[model samples]
Target: MIRVEEAIAIVEANSTKMPVKQISVSKALGYVLAEKVISPINMPPFRQSAMDGYAFKHSIRHQYDIVGVSQAGDHSNIKLKTTEAIRIFTGAFVPDNADTVVMQEHVMANKESILIAAMPEKNTNVRPKGEQIAKGEVVFEANTLITPAAIGFLASLGIMTIAVYKKPKSAILVTGNELVKPGQKLKKGKIFESNSVMLQAGLQTFGLEKTKVYRVKDNLKATKKALESILNKFDIVLISGGISVGDYDFVKEALLQNDVKELFYKINQKPGKPMFFGSKNETLVFALPGNPASSLTNFYIYVAPAIKNKMGFAEIHKPKLVRKLNADIQNTTGKTLFLKAKYDETNVTVLDGQSSAMLNTFAVANSLLIVPQEIEEYKKDELVTLLPID
Candidate 1:
């Protein structure tokens, strides 16, 4: 069996970003930029008023006559001279001769002449041309995820459309004869199916908006039929359960029967050692464990990053923070473990229940306490890597 890091390296080596496509700025959110976005023109293209006030020459300190009124989107060029001011609203273009703006509250206006109570400062209340962004400047770089802020910034630069990487289509399959739908009556020894829903939600956090899920029974024929039907339709297939050594576990057998090339099966990790990975034609497949916690952990630590890479995201991994353990932790000598933990600004406490079959503990966990296989006992206050839960 390979180590978890080694397996991740293999997955990364095989993954590639999807093709780029042109999309409107509205639909570009969460998609990776395929090309650099350069400003076609200066932001605020011309000098405009940053406040609702009077536009006048800063050199004139005395009261001036109100020559004309300027509102936003008005194109009339009304230049100001000494002892002359123009009534201007916010965002209106400043005339060529005006060098400053005096707030309306600071001036007493009449029909013809306005009383200036305070002197205007040079360049005050003025939004200079290209102050926010310069023409031909790169506003966004390639491989960046287009967030809400990015979209707003691009739109401010008068960009209506952008080129972004296409999102990958993924199919999720959960296989187990003993598994039953959530609303169905449970039989003896049967368990409710939850891995499919959990995996789907997890994938969405990585910006996967489109996902298809299927439930296949624990049989070679049924599994093989399902794989064959969806082989070419999805970029990746996530299968849960029936990958272990038990006689009823037929997922590995079904993949082989369907000519799915096995990449690697099993890894040196707790609760996920029975995991399997393969490929049939161009579709990548992962046969995850049956336990809910195991499935989620495997997806986060491995599958999620692979899918993000395929979606053109440059940084595929989640953020990790260094935390100090509040109590001592003991584990086996071999196989890495991801223990559910809760942490705050001061300390991190590992949950008492660390079993792969337990779901309640994982529910309250804010982070995963990662323990290496070589360490047997972690002393209190020892610094460890904490992977945050999405």
Candidate 2:
């Protein structure tokens, strides 16, 4: 057994970045860049027009002769004299001789001549070449997250692919003969298996999409066999059930037999005190309590951070906040308590149904109120720590 902080530290020390792989930028959303990305060409490769307007060399005169027209994508070599202008559209290349552009709305056009209703400043409405980004400039440094806007920026720089830290391959193992898959008729003393589905969704929320699920009977032989196969094939393995010191709890023994070194077997925390963390070679394993709420709580507090670390994220934990308590609460269990609750920017309210088996409150709760072991009670409006659930 270990304290919650010590268990969290152990997990963090063991988690490492995965190998890098080159993937298309278009498909690299939510991935951390393993290499610095450089721009191959200047954004707005040429001096572009910023508006549908007339391009002209700046002069003191209010009127000018319209020499020619230039639309976007036109490779025009037309030159302009001082006091001469050309009809131009948005994004159109401004002739080298032209230094300014006046929006169409600001100019009065009559036949081949235009009068600037308002004399514009020099370089107005003209996007200078390389204004956004210069060629050979570092677009993003290593460990940068590829957001949707990042994809567009990279695409604009003509970057087709980027090197990113590879996402971990993970699997979920559900243990217990008393569990039955959903849609099946419930036999005597059998319950529908939901931990696997809930865990799968939880993993997806952390960006681990390609997860495999396995079912095992609550026996040493079956549990060991499942562990052997999964530990060798996955970077992460999540087992729900069979971890406590029960007659049929074979997961802990099976893991040890399979040479999985236990980092910590339990944590001094509420709802998930029986949680287990171990590693077999390079594969990380988490044995969560079978109770639905406990499994999910452990997944968020521990597994999600491991996933983020493997993918090279700097900030792994969910956002932590401190707010005044909206209601009084007590915890006399002599253990740190994690209570699902509702929170706004300034305050938090611990909801009912803090039982390890119930997830109804968790479904509606947006945060977890952390009650320290030393604090037996907290008065309403007292400051407290909260972790907003994602």
Candidate 3:
């Protein structure tokens, strides 16, 4: 078995980002831009009023004549003299001679004229043309992540579509003879299958929602057939169970029979020592242990990064930090240990029920405490490294 760091490096070194494609900006949230976008026109497009008030050329006078009204979406051609003002609402186009606006609350209005309460500064309450952004300027650089605000900004700029990295197509294969569907009746010596749904949910968290799932019994022919069918059709293939060295464990041999190049067989880590990673052409394959907790942990540590890297993300790993341990813990397995725990900003506490087959502790865990092989014991208040789940 290889070390955990070595396994992670291997997976990252083999990943390649997907090709770019053009998509509508309305549906491009959470996608990374593949090219820089330039503004086609100046934001606001014209001199705009910043408030509902009277607009006129600023002068030393305290009273002025009100000529006409300018609503938000209409063009106003009203001419203003030196001591003349026009009623203008917010976002309305300002007349050519209007240089300043006094808010309606600060002025007294009458039938055909308004009296200013106080003399205002020149060019106040007016949004100059191109104030937000100028035309022909770079609005967003390459590798920018699309957010809700970004969508609105682009839509306001009349941008209908943008170029982005296409998300990878993925597939999952579940292999076990003693597994049954969740709603079905439990026969003798049978357990409900939970890894497929768990892994699917994990993938969906990273914007990989469209995935195909397949199931096969512990048979070599069936496993090989399943592998052969999807080996070249998808960018990632995740297989759960049948990777260990047992009589019914036929995943390794089936992968070999299908001409898949094995990158690594196992890792020197707890709860996931029998993990397998391989590749056939461009398809990356990960065969995880059948245990629900182990499968989910390996998915988060290994598979999540691979998916993110393929989608052209810069930061693929979970956020890491060092904090003091709230309670004592020990590791004597001579391998890296990943324990589910809860952490405040100051300290981390390892939760109970750290069994490989159980996910009770993981359900409440906000982070995974990493205990290296060189450390045997950690007392309370000792510093520890953790990967906080996002």
lDDT string, candidate 2, 1-390, tens digits: 677888888999899899999999999998999989889999889999999989998889999999898999996958888868999999988899898999999988987899999988999999999999999999999888889999999998889999999989999999988999999999999999999999999888767888999999999998999888899999999999999999999999999999999899989999899988999877999999999999988988899899999888868987789999988898889898999989887888889999999989999998888988788999999999987885
Tens digits of per-residue lDDT for model 3 on 190-294? 999999999989888868788899999999999999999988789999999999999999999999999999999999998788999999988899999999888
Compute each candidate's TM-score over C-alphas: 0.95, 0.96, 0.93
Tens-place lDDT per residue, model 1, 75-180, is 7788667878899999998998888898999989888988888877799999999998999988988888899999998888779999888887888988887888
Q: RMSD of candidate 1 to the true fold? A: 1.7
lDDT, each prediction: 0.86, 0.91, 0.91
Q: After superposition, how far is residue 336 of candidate 3 from its true place, in Å?
A: 1.6
**lDDT of model 1 at residue 180?**
85
Candidate number with greatest TM-score: 2
Ranking by lDDT: 3, 2, 1
Candidate 3: give the clashing pairs. Answer: none
Question: How much is the lDDT of residue 38 in candidate 2?
Answer: 87
